[model samples]
Target: MSADTLITLDTPTDGTTVSGSFDAKGTANSPEANVPWRILDAGGQKVLHGHFTAEGWMDKLYPYAGTVDVSKLAPGSYTFEVSVDDPSGGEGKAPQKVDRSITVQ
Candidate 1:
């Protein structure tokens, strides 16, 4: 699958600075409309993770929006990533993922 067609993040764009809670909004086309996400510290250590369902799926890309809280995390740079859920467990092609850097204050 083409990387560009897999997913797109619209809010909290790259190099953004956020505090407390922030919105994560984007569009994605993946199995069962499942959009899994994670936050990693600069050292590449996972800090937060979870999954959220899209508004719709199957025929085309659907919108997904959710809130991520960083109030408990220490102030620093981190990576926010969203990946397509591949239930095939590698039997199919590799999953697609998109990530961006952000600074938490």
Candidate 2:
């Protein structure tokens, strides 16, 4: 993913198989700091939830590095995403979500 995008998952690229816990580093940008993230099962249930932290997150592009904890999940397919909250309760501005599918072993 490019630094200019809204968010990017660098490790465990899409459709990659993995096991246990692994490093998950990516870049994200929100209208604010610390955009939330989650790992979802194939059924779309949230399994792991967390947020991204950057040195600076002021309506600009930034990097968020963290580990994706999947040690407790059974072998299956899941998805991960980085999301941003809606900028106020107004029209035309809604939450942003980006996701990719992965396999667990």
Give TM-scores for every candidate, taking all chains together and pairing residue i with residue i: 0.90, 0.78
**Candidate 1 at 8: error in angstroms?**
0.7
lDDT of 2 by residue, 1-105 (tens): 555567666775788788988777766676666677889998899998987675456576677777777889899999987776446755665566777788999
- Ten-residue segment with the worst summed lDDT in candidate 1? 1-10
In TM-score terms, which candidate is top? 1
Give me the runs in candidate 1 sitting further than 4 Å from their true place: 1-4
lDDT of each: 0.89, 0.75
lDDT (tens digit, per residue) of candidate 1 on 1-105: 454587878987999999998899998987899999999999999999988789877778899989998899999999999988889988988788889999999
Alpha-carbon deviation at 89 in model 2, angstroms: 7.7
The parts of candidate 2 lying over 4 Å away from their true place are 1-5, 86-92
Residue-pair clash count for candidate 2: 0
